[model samples]
Target: MIEDQLTEDDVLLPTYGPRPVTFTSGAGSWLTATDGGRYLDFLCGLAVTGLGHAHPVVTQAVADQAARLTHTSNLFGTRPVLELADRLRRTLGWDDGRAFFCNSGAEANEAALKLARRHGKHADPQKVHVVALDKGFHGRLMGALKLTGNPAKHAPFEPLGTWATHVPADDPDAIAAAVDDRTCAVWLEVVQGEGGVRPLSEEVLAAARAACDDHDALLVVDEVQTGVGRLGEWYGWQTTTVEPDVVCLAKGLANGLPIGAIVARGVAAKAFQLGDHATTFGGGPVVCAAANAVLDTIESDGLLAHTRAMGSRLAAGLEALAADSPLVTGQRGRGLLRAMTLSGDFAPAVADAALRHHLVVNAVAPDAVRLAPPLNVTPDEVDEALSRLRAAVADVASPTGASPTGASPTGAAPAETDGR
Candidate 1:
C-alpha cells in the first residue's frame, strides 16, 4: 500500500533530485522497481553494498542481534562491538590498532579530524592545520567538509574554518609543500570515488607518508568506499607502497547497515584519551554484529581474491566496449571501483539512458561514468551489466537520438554539470 504512494519524492527534503525509480525488492546484483522491472545494479548504492542486496550473512546477523540486544550506549561494553573492533584490527594487520565507531563515513572523518587536532595540540598548540588533496571527497559534516578538497561543496557553506589546505592530488611536490610543522593530518582516498573514480599515484602516497613522518602529522586514509575488500585488499592503502597511520572506513563495512569507524595504530592510536569523542548510536551491537558478519563472509567466501578476478573481467569488458564504442575514451580505477571516461561531458545523459535500459549506474563526474559493482559480483552478472551498458551507450550515441543536455552526440561537451 505504501509502495503505491511512494512513486514521488515530494514529501522528503530537497537534498536529492528526483529519484529515477522506487525499488521494492532486491537480491544480489539486481533490484526490482515498482513497475516490476529488474535492473542490473552496477553502482552498488555508490559502492556501499559490496556483498549485494539482502546478503544472507549480514541479514541473518542483524536479525539475530536485533532480536537479542540492540543498544547499550558507549558507556557500557557490548560483545558485538568489542568483537568487531578486534576483527577490524586483524583485517588491517594492525596489532596495536584502536577503532572509534560512528554512523557514517562523514562521522568517521570528523572523529579523525578531532583526533588529529588533539594529537597536534598535545605537541604544539599552533599545529592544527590539515592537508588534503584537491577533488577528494571526505564528508558532508562541517568539520569533514572543511577537510574535503572540493571547494564547490564548500562555496554555499563558506567560511568553514581555515584549518585545511588543499593541493593537487597527483603532484607529490605539492603534497610535500603543503605539509609542514604546523600540519596535524593529511587526508586522502585511495580511489577518489566521488571524484570520478580517480586513483592516486604511488608517488603521492609515498610523499604523504614521508611528509607526515617529517612533520609529526597523521596520514589518514579515507577508505569509506574502498575498504573491506572493495579494492582487492582489506584496505586501499595496502595496495600502495606506503601505509597510513589511520584509516576512515564505512560504506561496505556493515554491508548496507549505517556504520563507520576510524582504525588507528602507533601514535595515532593513542591520540584519543578518555572523554575525548563519542557517539550515541555508534558501535551498537546490531550494527557491529552486521559488520562482523560482513567480514566473516568475506573471509569465508574468499572475496578479496574473487574481487580481483572479477575486476579483471569487468576491466576487460569495459576496454572491449571502449574499443568498439565511439563514446568511450578510456577506463581507470583499482579493482571493482572503476570509471569509463567519455570523449565529452555526456556521462549524465548516458547514465539517464542506462536507467531507461534497466541498468543502475551514475556519472561520478561530467565525463566519467563510474561503475562500482558488488565485491562478490559473479562473472555472469558482470557480463550482463556490460551488455546492458553497451545498449545504453548505443541508445545515447545514436545519430537521430535526442541528447538530454542539448549537445551533439559526436563528442561535443554537454552542459558541464555533475550528473549525480
Candidate 2:
C-alpha cells in the first residue's frame, strides 16, 4: 500500500502517534519505503524482528503451516505447540515446567500476574501485593500496567485494582524494604528495555531474590524485551545470579508473528487450575510453526554469538562517539538491546536527522536513543549504523540544529543508573 492511501489516519485507531515514515517492505536490516527510498533499520520494530524481516526460514515455516493447519481449539492438541513448548523449556533450562501461551507481552504478563495472585493466596490471603522497580515496564493491560512503575501511562486509566508497589531501580535497600511477607510477588526486568536500555544492578537483583526467598513470594522476571536471545543469552535472567520462579516472554518469539508465553516452575506451575486460564489463539499451529523456525534458524546460524559480537562492536563504536561528541552522555545496555543518552532533549532531533540520512531509530525517552537491531545484523551493518548515528548526532548538535529548546547542548548528567 502507498503512504497516502494507507496513512494511519485514513483508516485505523487514533491511538498511535504520527510516524515519520511508512514502510512498504523490509529485508534483513533494511526497509523500503513507498517513496522508493531505503533505510537501515536499527530499531527492528522495537526488537520484534530479531531474525530480520522476511527471513527465508521463518517465512517458509509460516507458509508450510498455513497450507496444512492454522488454528484449532484448545480442546485438541497440536504438534507444533507441544514442540515449541519443549523447545522453550530446553532453551531456558526450565526443565519439566509448564507454559501458558498468549498473544502479546501484556497477555503473557497478565497470566503471570494471575498465577502469582493465585499462588499468593495459597500462603496468605492478603499476600496480593506485587513489588516492581522504578522505570520497569511490564505491559499496557490493566493487570500488567499495575505492575509497571510508570505512573503517567497508568494515570489516565485510574482505579486499577491490583495493589502493586514500586521501588527505586537498582536500589537494594528499597527493594528489601518493599518486598516482605505481605508481598506475593516481585516483578522485575533484568534489563529495562523501554525505560531506556538500563540494566538492573546485580546487587538489587540479588536482594530481590533473597527477599522473595525470605517472604515466600514468587520471583517473577519480565523478560518481554530482554528474552528470546535479545540479550546475548536466551534470557536476561541468565546473566544474573537470580533465577525466577515465573518468566514472561513475547517479543521476537515468532519473529514478526504475535506470540507470548509464561514459563513457570515448581509449585508456581500448578497455580492455575484447568479452567482458570485459556487463550484461543495462544498456541495456534501457524504461529508455533513459525516460532520453531525462528529457534531453528537462531541455532543453525549462530545468531547468539553474532549478536554478542555485533553488540560489542556497537557498544565500542558508541563509546568512541561519546569521546568525540559532547552531545553524547554515555553508553548503556547489552547485546543488541542498547541506547545512547543524548544531551538536552535532542534524542528526537537525532532520530529525525537519522531518518533524513536513511536510518531508522527510536527516541524512547527525551534523552535516550534506542538501537535494537536484528540479531543477525553483520559487523558492516553495525558500522554503517554507527556512522549514520554520528552524523545524526552531529546535525542535532549543530548551531542551527533541530533541538526543540534551541539551546546550547549541555551534556546529560552522569547518572547512568536511571532505569529505562
Candidate 3:
C-alpha cells in the first residue's frame, strides 16, 4: 500500500541494505509502515531508541530547544551542553573527568583514540600501539576502523592506520598477551554488539584493567551500543567490577538525535588541551537538549529498573524457546540487547520471516539474530514477540533441515501457559 511516489530519491548514502518497508511513524515499541502495517520493532534503530520512537519527552525537548536556539558554534557556551555534561558526569560517577562531544559513535570513538594517542605521546612517543578485541566493532571512520578488529571490514581499507593489535574477546590470557609497555590504549566493548552480542567476562575485563595499569596504558570502554539503559545501567562497564579510564558513548545518548561523547577520567582527562579537539555540531543546543531530556525521562520514569525487568523477561522467553529447539544453539547478552544463535546460517531467513510476521529484528552475524527492543516494551508485546519468533524459527528450521542435534525440525514448540 505504499504510495507510488515513495521512492529512495533523496537517499544519497549506500551504507545500508534496507528492507522493503518504509516506516512513516512509530510509537513505543511499534512502527507504522508507509503501507499502514504495524510492526513490533525489536531492532530499536540498533539500540538507539532507548525510550522508543517519538518519545514525548524527547519530542518536547527538541521542539522547545529549537524554538529557543538550535546551534551555537563551540565559540560560545550553551546552557544545554553544560547541563547535559554535568548530568553525564554525575550519572556515570566519573571524578575529575572531561568530555568531548561529536555527532556520532564513530566520532566519539575517533576522539577517544586521538586522546589515547595524546596521552601516550605525553608518556612516551614509543607507547603508540593500541590493542583491541577480535571481532570487536568500534565504528567506521579511519581511526575508529583502525581500532575495530574485524578483518573483513578492514581489508578494503587496509594501510589505513598503524599501531593496532587484536586479541580474542573474553580471553584474559589473550588480552594479557597483547598488552605491553608500548601499548597506548586497550579498547573493548562491554558486550560485543556487531560481533554477535557476546558479553566480555568479568575476569577478562579485570585482567585488561590490570594489564593497562601495569603498562601505563589507557583502558577505553566503547559504550556506544551498551550505554543509556540498554544494558540495565547508565553504562555497561558499570555492571562490571573493572572501571575504564575513558568511555565512548552514543546511540541512545540523545534518543535518535546525533550526539557522541568521549569521557576521560583521572590523568587521562588531561590528555587534550583547549585547542587539541573541536567539532562544529558536537554539542549543539538542540541535540544537548534532547540528550538532557532523555536522561531526565529515563530517571523520572524509572526506565532503568524497567529495562532490567523487561530484559529478563525477554531473555527468559528466548532461553525457554532455545531449550527445546535444536535450531537455536545458544543465547547471550544482557538487558534489552540480546541475541540467539542458530545451528546454521539462517539469520537472514529468520529475520525475513519475522518481518513477514510484522516484527523487526536484525541479523548481527551469519547465524545470530539480535534483539534490542525498546526498554519500555510491554509484557504483552514481549509475549506476542515470543510467540511470533517461535513460529518464525519453526518455519525456517522445518523447510531447511533439522539441526545437528537430531531434534525435530520444528525444534521446540511455544509454551501453552499463556503468560500474557
What TM value does model 3 have?
Answer: 0.93
| Model 2 misplaced stretches (Cα beyond 4 Å) | 1-6, 403-420
**Can you write out model 3's per-residue Cα lDDT over 1-420, one digit (the tens) per residue?**
665655565454644544458889999989999789999989888889988899998999999999999888999999999998888888889857778899999999999988998999898988889999998989889888888888877888889767899988868998899899899899999999988899999989998999999999999999999998899998999989989999999999998999999888998999898799889999999999999999999899898899999899988999898997887877789999999878866676677777788888877876788999988889999989888888878867775533332233345522111000
Segments in model 3 whose C-alpha atoms lie over 4 Å from true places: 1-6, 9-13, 400-420
Q: Write the per-residue lDDT of candidate 1 for residues 1-420, one digit (tens) a residue.
A: 875565455567777767768899989999999889999899988799999999987899999999999989999999998999999999999999999999999999999999999999999999999999999998899998998888878999988998999999999999999899999999999899898899999899999999999999999999999999988999998899989999999999998889999999999999999899989999999999999999999999999999999989988999999999988887899889999888877788788878888889888888888898999899998998899888878877886553555343664545443422
Candidate 1: which stretches are off by over 4 Å?
Answer: 1-3, 6-9, 402-420
TM-score comparison, 1 vs 3, better candidate = 1
Candidate 1 lDDT (Cα, whole model)? 0.89
Clashing residue pairs in candidate 3 are none
Question: Judged by TM-score, which candidate is best?
Answer: 1
In model 1, the clashing pairs are: none
The 0-to-1 C-alpha lDDT of every candidate, in the order given, reads: 0.89, 0.87, 0.86
TM-score for each model: 0.97, 0.95, 0.93
Worst 10 residues of 3 by lDDT: 411-420
Question: What value does the lDDT take at residue 214 in candidate 2?
Answer: 91
